[model samples]
Target chain A: MSEPESDSISKGKDGLTIHTVSKDRLLEFMKDMKERGFNHLSLITGVDRRDYVEVVYHLHAMDRDEYVVVKTTTDNGVVPSMTSLWNSARWDEREQYDLMGIKFEGHENLKRIFLPENWVGHPLRKDYDLSNVQYINMDEDGEDYATFDQGDGW
Target chain B: MNNFVELNFGPQHPSTHGVLRLRAKLDGEIVRELEPIIGYLHRNAEKLCELTFYADNLIFFDRMDYVASMLMESGYLEAAEKILNIPPPERVLWIRVIMNELSRIASHLVWAGAFGLDLGMLTPFFYCFAQRDYILDVFTEVCGSRQETNYMSVGGVYQDLTPEMIEHIDAFLQSFPKKLEEIYRLFVKNDIFISRNKGIGVLSKETAIDYGVTGPMLRASGVNYDVRKANPYLVYDKVDFDVPISQKGDNLARFLVRFEEMRQSVRIIKQAITKIPDGPFFNPKAKKSMMIRLRGDGEYYARTESPKGEFGVYIVGDGGVKPYRVRVRSPSFKNLSVLPVLAKDQMISDLISISGTIDLVFGEVDR
Candidate 1:
């Protein structure tokens, strides 16, 4: 289901227009875009929406010299994956899983990317803990530091 | 169908390039499929940029492309300057050019050394470092910090380049071209080197650009897209140098492009040194008060031709001392994007040669 050519999609930063498309039609949208010459998938980043998680795909069409931002949001637990369309989305989605706790369904080998498999809690979450967590001293001294409370909740 | 053996190349192995881990399935010596596992060395560089002041962001920028720290620093500094609407003086731009060129030479030298070492030659590593140490020494003289230099401030440099330091750079530039020829003659023509690199891991122009591959890797594919040329920044337009391109797009071609790039850097420096105008360094209008003023708010993308590729800095300001959001579009990340596609159907032995040709510093790739 291709949107009409005359219809201008949602416009965001840098004059980039955000287009909303149904998950079922994503692959067709991508193929239609390729036919129209949007060949470059510049960046694939994820943003956290309180009730759900959103995935943003930034595609730059070399032929048109314009950028289009396509967004896909998933329900709280359902992971709507788009790896089949853009292979580059695989790692970017895995990273979203690791940091924002958003899983990508149908990701061939989805796993923790930027964080250790044993790490607890998604650090990038707004409610993620900043205190009482272990931190490594990268510079000198070679000390491992943590801010865990030793007494009753103060 | 089930003849392939699965091999986990690295999470810690030396040849995998940085902390990168790859799971490859091979049929005899030929790689059937390869999955790149990255983010081992991630430090959330983007998030770190948001926490620091606009001027202080250079400190972290250097570490992203550790091989070409000056280019990364200059890229960020130029972007911040653009957002603030402040133009650094002529001398500062010249200094930025000189430092950037020197860093390019240093980065290529390290790449040469590491590539040689990867291919089982030890002499080039030592020889490359011997020259690299001199560049580091020059960096220490001007910036007072060698590797991690927050030297390039938003409107200008940390300090002036002393005449003595300029003489040292001039002397090095004069002798460096000869050393470059010597290294090339020793390494490039070697039979084993030729055999290892001749036709290994080929990437086409369409794939390279689609993956947003920049710098030498893209140039090796016969695509003449150098940010310095297509997107000129920081006085790159005033000076002249040819962007060497190769059609092979193989491991050897990538190596050749860097070799020519180092030579081009020298040419640019020679011209820059002769024509460098004498003037003040930093912009006086730049906020020098205890509380730095970030007067305007806007998003700016400044990309420079880093030794590795096009290192881009995307900054979002809120008219405050600190950036509201900062995103670093690292070349290594985009360069590594094509690895899985390229590595498929190649031999396991060719993996190192292929990865070496890309020359990704994990600090930038995983950052």
Candidate 2:
């Protein structure tokens, strides 16, 4: 895929530029940023938009004093991962996978990061069924997350 | 290079600090490679954020970095306010600062205790706990919870502090410095302490920045970057305190940063307590209809310099009762990235010392 013009990108609130990149040019863009000294990939978080997936990479440039939020869209079935470029992306991808059912394609090791390995559905998805979900004991008081009904059922 | 042996450090071990295990590849006494295995204490904090309303999310935020829960609560509230376009009142901001600094002191006390225990010193841990117990009493009086205060909310703090609570804080603030001095006098110049920590686990400035290290760990590497001062969240811009930095970039440098940071935190608390005005704690006039309404349909990133480092809350609000999506940029996770590289050639015994210096709370790491 051909690289889009620079004007296509928009600036984020925290001074990060939001670039819409295709899967083919994503690696090239990441490499360009790394060469420009965005050596630290601060965070990789996913958002589920029902019809599509939005993967945001919070990258920081220590030498240049800049940060950019690189975002890419994927179809519901295809959640492209950036673990190959940044090792720290591994955990974030696993977290995205565990909660939003987004698969980190090139992750060397990806599993349920914060939830049980056998959880039925992505709990963060809009259509997640809470009624049938089993409770997770989180604290010393044995607070089961499943039993506590989210009053609005959203 | 005859063989490489595998060593398993526990999910239950004392030094692991609350359900964190690492399977290390060892070549004699030197570590060949290290794989951190987490999730024993994972509570799915982000998922829980999606399931509940924003107001109720404060309680869960407290659990993220339970040792410094007040900071996490503040981060969440700050992010929520950004989305709602609401600035907390001056009194609320002062209260938030007071609670946050106290939490920092409390967290450092525990860290000092645990770090000493890991380094084979028992007395410091006891001394730290005694000091921490008194601080927890102050926390419990204000928020009704000792460890996890959950005192922060969207528009402001949960409630106004009583005069008695202010008196208690005043007394604690006065005595805390003396107790800190006593601890410092006991261990700061101790020959054995210096030998164990100084020149151990030396992380260079270049590598520290490359690994995205923050908080005391990064400050110790001579980085003057502090989110509170550099970015100035809440009322930190108005507060007068020094950002302590060390050029040594060793375990001792990290240790010294924590010590100095505690003193600075106390200084901040003193100013906030003395200057805080008698006004409405929360913006009681935040139109009743606006309580559940999320005003914006965009994303906001709210980052705060917690005791542990940069605790950030990234939220995508969709003008709904619940946040569209919530992502926590936990400092521990970022700090842990530098571990394998840091541990590449260090002796096995130095591993715990290095780990303790970084102060990775598993709750935040695994969240």
The residue pairs that clash in candidate 2, if any, are: none
User: Where is model 2 more than 4 Å wrong at Cα?
Assistant: A1-7, A11-17, A76-87, A115-122, A134-154, B285-296
lDDT of 2 by residue, B1-367 (tens): 6488999999899887778788899998999899877788877788788778777788888888889998899988878877767778888888888888988999999999999888888999999999999889988888788887877777877667999999999999889899998887667778988887889888888777666677899889987878887778778888899999999999989988899999999999889888888887777645445566545457877788887788878988888878889999998877876888788888998998888887978889888
* lDDT tens per residue, model 1, A32-132: 77667777666655555456665666676644545677766766634567676555566666766887788776888778877665566775554555554
Give the alpha-carbon lDDT of every model. 0.77, 0.81
Scored against the true structure, residue B157 in model 2 reaches a CA lDDT of 75
For model 1 chain B, the run of ten residues with the poorest summed lDDT = B287-296
Tens-digit per-residue lDDT, B1-367, candidate 1: 8987998988888776688898889899988888788877888777676667776677788888887898888988767887777789889998999999999999999999999988998888888888888899999998888887677887778788877888898999888889888888878779999999988889998877667777899889998778788767778999989999999999989989999998999999888888888888788876457226655476565667888887766666777777755667777877887898788888777888888888879998888
Best by TM-score: 2
- The residue pairs in collision within model 1 are A10-A18
Could you tell me the TM-score of candidate 2? 0.89
